[model samples]
Target: MKILVFMKQVPDTAAPISVKDNQVDASKIDKYAASPYDEYALEQALQIKDKAADTKITLVTLGPARVREMIMQGLAMGADDAVIIKHEPAKHGELVEPNDLDGLAVANVLAAAAKKIGYDLIYTGTKGVDDDQGWVGIAMGELLGLPLVAGARSTEVSGGTARVLRDVEGGKEKLEVSLPALITSSQATEPRYPTLKGIMGAKRKPVLEWDIASLGVAADALASRVERVALDMPPGRQAGRLLLGEPNDQVQELVRLLREQAKVI
Candidate 1:
């Protein structure tokens, strides 16, 4: 079986963040190994590969050269190979610069890259923590003509089909799908860390590169522009007042303020 995992590089959460010129100042951010949500997708892929050692699991990502670091992490976690769509770095942001791709455009590029791979199953993070747009997998599935299952907590593959369990707002639901479907994983599932040997082995695994021209996508497909923007931090919230007094006094004062002064009850 051939499986594909879509991955992405994001600003490390621990790094100090600031909004400048309406773009994230990521130059000084200390990059983490991989995204937490995508880690669940990787873990699910590894688990699938573990059961069937013959399974070929590959990864795909989009970003600057530093993004390959994330692909390497997936390799270390036991994905057999990888493909990285390298985006040119810019002073502001990729969205503000060339290949002006939003989350949907990025998804378009990914769909183009995976179009010919003929993967039996595709795995992805339910949502990117950085963007939180939750469009990539759905967009790819739409472009590729495959069924989509989001918030997947567990999955099973058999006879060229998949049985998935997805976590909804209040509970969970099950879906049985044929092969060649897309599934987005969430924290309802657990991801595995790489073993030392797996890390060393990943160094020699294949890492392929692709671009717009090779992927046969038009400049228009990635054509998107910027508009209204905000370049500063939101005003910090003021501390709340602490009502300290006799129980009855505090209640009376609170009620009066809510009803007469604040006009909110």
Candidate 2:
């Protein structure tokens, strides 16, 4: 069996960020990490590889050169090989944030690469932490005309088919799908940390690099459909007010504040 996992590099959630000239100043971020959801996707692929014979897991990512490290990290986590759909900002002579490519563009790029590299199953994160955009996997499935199970919590593959369990409104729903499908993993399982041996082996793993031109994707397909007009941080928290008085007096004061200041009443 051949499996493919789509991964991405994301700034740490706690990393400090600011906006300047309508673009986020990511230089202030001290660290970058793989997307949490994608890690789960990788873990799911690795689990399947462990059980199935002759299974090879390949990691795929789309980003600038800086993201190669993130892809290597996935290799260390046990993916057999990797492919980077590379984008070079210097070549374009402009700074392009990851978000510059909308979900459609990202899906387009991944679909093109997946077509180039055939696979029986494809795995991806349910959503990206940075943008919280959960559209890529489903969109890619649509573009490829394949069955997709988005936000799958658990999956079992056997005899040319897969059974997936996913969260619903108040419970879980199970689905049975044929081979050659896409599954977007979320809360599947805890991601495994790279062992020393795995880390050392990752250095020798092959990572093929491809560009939009090589993929035969039109330039227009890579264009961002949405433009950012402005960016700003949420308002800071306000200090809490203490209502110190008799119970009745406190209630009256609280009601007054809620009615007049908060204006909820």
Candidate 3:
């Protein structure tokens, strides 16, 4: 079996972010890591490889050259090889920023690459950390004409079918999808870290780099559908207030506050 996992590099959520001139000041950011949710997707693929020794796992990422750091991490985690869809402005015209592209555009590019590199199944994070727009995986499935299981917390493949468990309104729903399907991974097991041996081996793994044009994706398809007006930090939180008095008075005051100032009631 062959599995293709779509991963991305995103700014570390813990890092302090600042906005300048209506855009995120990239200079203020320092740390970057694999999107947390994508790690979950990679973990799922690695677990499958653990069971099926013959399975081949490949990591696919679309971004600038810096994304190689994230790719190396995935390779260290057990992906057999990797493909980097290089988004260089100088080489690929003006459409090079992966983060700037809308979900549909990004999906189109990835779907095209997926077609070039065959796969029996595809895995992706439910949403990216930076945008939190959970559209790429679903959009890819639509573009590829493949069945998709979204928010899959657990999955098992057998006899050309994949059984997926996903979260529903209050509980979980189990679904069985045929092969050549896409699954958007949610929370399942904790993602594993690369060990010393795995890290060393990752240095030698094969990495195939390709430009968007090589995938035959039209330049117009990469156009942004949405426009960003500005970026700003959220307002700071307010301090809490105390209602001091007898128990009954405090309860009454709390009710009054809820009904008046808080207005929650």
Candidate 4:
């Protein structure tokens, strides 16, 4: 099976968030890294490739030129090839919220690219670590007119189909679908990391680059569905509230508050 893994370039969650000029000021954010969740998706594809010798794992992403760093990291992990969608990182305050960009435009370009190559399987992380929008896989599925099994905790590909188990709000859901499908893996999923030799060999693999002009996802063709109105850092957190008293006194006071003041009861 051939696979395409959808990846993202996300802010290093480790870096503190700073808001300036009504933007994230991500330019100043230290250590841009692969979206943490996308790491799991990359690992998932690698594991499948290792288990199936015929499988070739490919990576694709839509972002500015700087996104190559994450794509290289994905290559170093075990992807056989990569595709970078070169476009300036559009300001969220100008267009749509960063999370909401997982729509027809981006999805159409990815679908067009992947369909050109003809893949049997596609994988993406459950959500972008930065925005946590949880839409790309579903959107890709829609654009490709394929089925999507999302938030999968585990997946096994066999017999020309994929078996997936996903966690819903509070329970698990099982799905079996034919090949040439899209799946989003959750944190609960486990995929093996690239070994030392695999990492070394990755340097020799292929990475295909394409521009918006080549892919036909021109800016004018991408109609905006939403626009960002404001951007700001979260307010500083307040100190914690502590309720203290003897055990019996605390219980009595809590009960009184529940019944009379707080009215929780």
Candidate 5:
């Protein structure tokens, strides 16, 4: 079985966020890392590959040149090979802003790539950690004319079909689909970190790079569905006040502060 896992490099969630010229300022970020949910998808693929003989787990990411780091990390975690969809021009070291590519364009390019190389199953995060645009997997499925199950918590494949369990409002929903399907993974088992040995071995693994033109996608045609009119940081938080003394006294003081100073009842 050939399983394709889609991933992305996003700004580290713990890093400080700042906006400049309506785009995230990369300089302020401490580092870039793989989107958390994408890692879960990768882990799921790895788990399956561990038990299934003749299975190959290949990772694909669409981003700027720096995205190679994210792909290498996945390689270190045991993916057989990787494909980097170079979003930026062959400008060498420079990285394009993540906002430059939207979900529609990403889905289109991914669908095209999948067609070029057939897969028994495809996996992706339900949404990207940075943009939270949860459209790519479903859109790719639509473009590829394949069945898709979103928010899958667990998946099991057998007899040329897959059984997926997904969380819902009150319970979980079970679904079975034939081969050549897509799954948007949600919260599941924790992702495994790359070991030192794995990291050393990853350096020898194959990492293929391809440009947007090579993917048969036009640069200008990827118009974003949502336009950013302005950008600003959220208001900074104020220092908190401590209420000392007895619990009853604190409750009374809190009420007074809420009524008089806060002006909320």
Candidate 6:
């Protein structure tokens, strides 16, 4: 089986975010890592490969040159090889920051590339950690005219069919999709760390880099429909107040505070 896994690099969630000129100050972010959810998707693909030794997993990413580091991590995690869609502003004039592209635009580029590189199944995270927009995978499925099962907790494949289990409002729902479908993975088991051997082998694995023009996608088609106007940090949390008294008195004071100051009552 040939499985394609979409991966993304994002600033570590713990990294402090600062806004400058209504945009994130990338200079302040010192660390970057794989999108957490994408790790889950990659792990799912790796698990499938584990069961079927012949399965081949390919990591696909659309981003700037720094994303190659994230691709190496994925390769270390057991993906056979990787393909990077270079997001260079000089080459692709319309391309600025790849993350700024809207879901439709990003999906169009990825879908076009996915067509160039065929796959039996596609996997990606349910949402990116940076934007938390869960639209790319779904939009890719639509653009590719393939069935998509989003937020899958687990997946089982056999005889060209994929059985997926996902969470609904109250319980899990099982879905059966034919081959050549897309699946957006949610958290299931913990993602595995790269073994020493895998890390060493990853350095020797093949990596193909492609420019936007190579995909034959028109620049206008990849133009973003959405624009980020500004970015602002969330308000700082206030310090909590402490009540010192008997249990009954504390309860009364808490209620009074809630009614008068907090005004939630």
| Best model per lDDT | 3
Of 3 and 4, the candidate ranking higher by lDDT:
3
Better of 3 and 6 by lDDT: 3
Cα lDDT tens digits, model 1, 126-151, are 87877667888888898889988887
Arrange candidates, best TM-score first.
3, 2, 6, 1, 5, 4
Rank all candidate structures by their lDDT, best first, as comma-separated numbers: 3, 6, 2, 5, 1, 4
User: Where does candidate 2 clash, by residue pair?
Assistant: none
* lDDT assessment of candidate 5: 0.85
Q: What TM-score, over all chains together, does every model reach?
A: 0.88, 0.91, 0.91, 0.83, 0.86, 0.90
Which should have the higher lDDT, number 2 or number 6?
6
Model 3: runs farther than 4 Å from truth? 89-98, 242-251
TM accuracy, model 1: 0.88
The positional error of residue 209 in candidate 2, measured at the CA in angstroms, is: 1.2
Q: On a 0 to 100 scale, what is the lDDT of residue 24 in model 4?
A: 66
TM-score attained by model 2 = 0.91
Q: Give the Cα RMSD of candidate 4.
A: 3.4
Off by over 4 Å in 6: 89-98, 241-250, 259-265
Residue 121, model 6: Cα distance from true site in angstroms: 0.3
Can you write out model 5's per-residue Cα lDDT over 192-261, one digit (the tens) per residue?
8898999999989988888767878666546667677776788889999999999999999999999999
For candidate 3, lDDT tens digit of each residue in 1-265? 9999999888899877776656566656788888988999999988888888999999999988899999998998889999999984332232223367889999999999999999999999999998788999999999999999999988888979999988899998999999999999987799998988999999899999999889998888888788878768898998889889899999999999999988999
Better of 1 and 6 by lDDT: 6
Off by over 4 Å in 2: 89-96, 255-265
CA RMSD of each candidate after superposition: 3.0, 2.5, 3.0, 3.4, 3.6, 3.1
Tens digits of per-residue lDDT, candidate 2, 176-224, equal: 9998999999877788898889999998999999987899888888787
Q: Candidate 1 overall Cα lDDT vs. reference?
A: 0.79
- Measured on C-alpha atoms, candidate 3 has an lDDT of 0.89
How far does residue 208 in candidate 1 sit from its true spot (Å)?
A: 1.0
Show model 4 residue runs off by greater than 4 Å.
Answer: 90-102, 188-191, 218-220, 240-265
